[model samples]
Target: MSSELETAMETLINVFHTHSGKEGDKYKLSKKELKELLQTELAGFLDGQKDSETVEKLMKELDENGDGEVDFQEYVVLIAALTVACNSFFWES
Candidate 1:
């Protein structure tokens, strides 16, 4: 059986691919793709956003290369940050 950590890692990759390639580059996430991924996968967390620029803000932050798109590595960074945040919240409680 795959280890728990292995499964989590796999889920990340799978989720990224599932929403990617809808527009440009099959390997990267366009702005719309990223928005869809966030809205669907992170509805609970992102639904609280009151700013219309939230998606644009996230895309800007995650697009470290300024490429206007998020590749796997950038997506992983976002996931890892959220994981860390969740870990802290759970442990602190």
Candidate 2:
């Protein structure tokens, strides 16, 4: 059986692929795919946002290669950053 951490890692990869395969490169996420993934998978993080530029900004920041898309490594960086934020929030409370 997979450990919880292993399962979580797998889930991250699966979720990325689910959205990444929808258009353009099958292994990278277009801005639209990133928006859909965020809206569906990370809605709570976006709940306070009031502008559509949020996704645009995220795409800009996460596109580390300046290739106009987010590959899995870039996506993993996002997840890692958010996880750190959540960890801090929980431990601080």
- On a 0 to 1 TM-score scale, where does candidate 1 land against the true structure? 0.92
Worst 10 residues of 1 by lDDT: 44-53
In order of appearance, the predictions have TM-scores of 0.92, 0.96
Q: Give me the candidate number with maximum TM-score.
A: 2
How far off is residue 56 in model 2, in Å? Answer: 0.7
**Model 1 root-mean-square deviation:** 1.2
lDDT of 1 at 48: 69
Q: What lDDT, from 0 to 1, does candidate 2 have?
A: 0.94
lDDT of 1 by residue, 1-93 (tens): 999999988998999999999999999999899988988898876876853478788889999999999999999988889889999999988
**Candidate 2 structure quality by residue, lDDT tens digits, 11-77:** 9999999999788999999999999999999999899894368889999999988999999999999
- Best-performing candidate as measured by lDDT: 2
Where does candidate 2 have its weakest 10-residue lDDT segment?
45-54
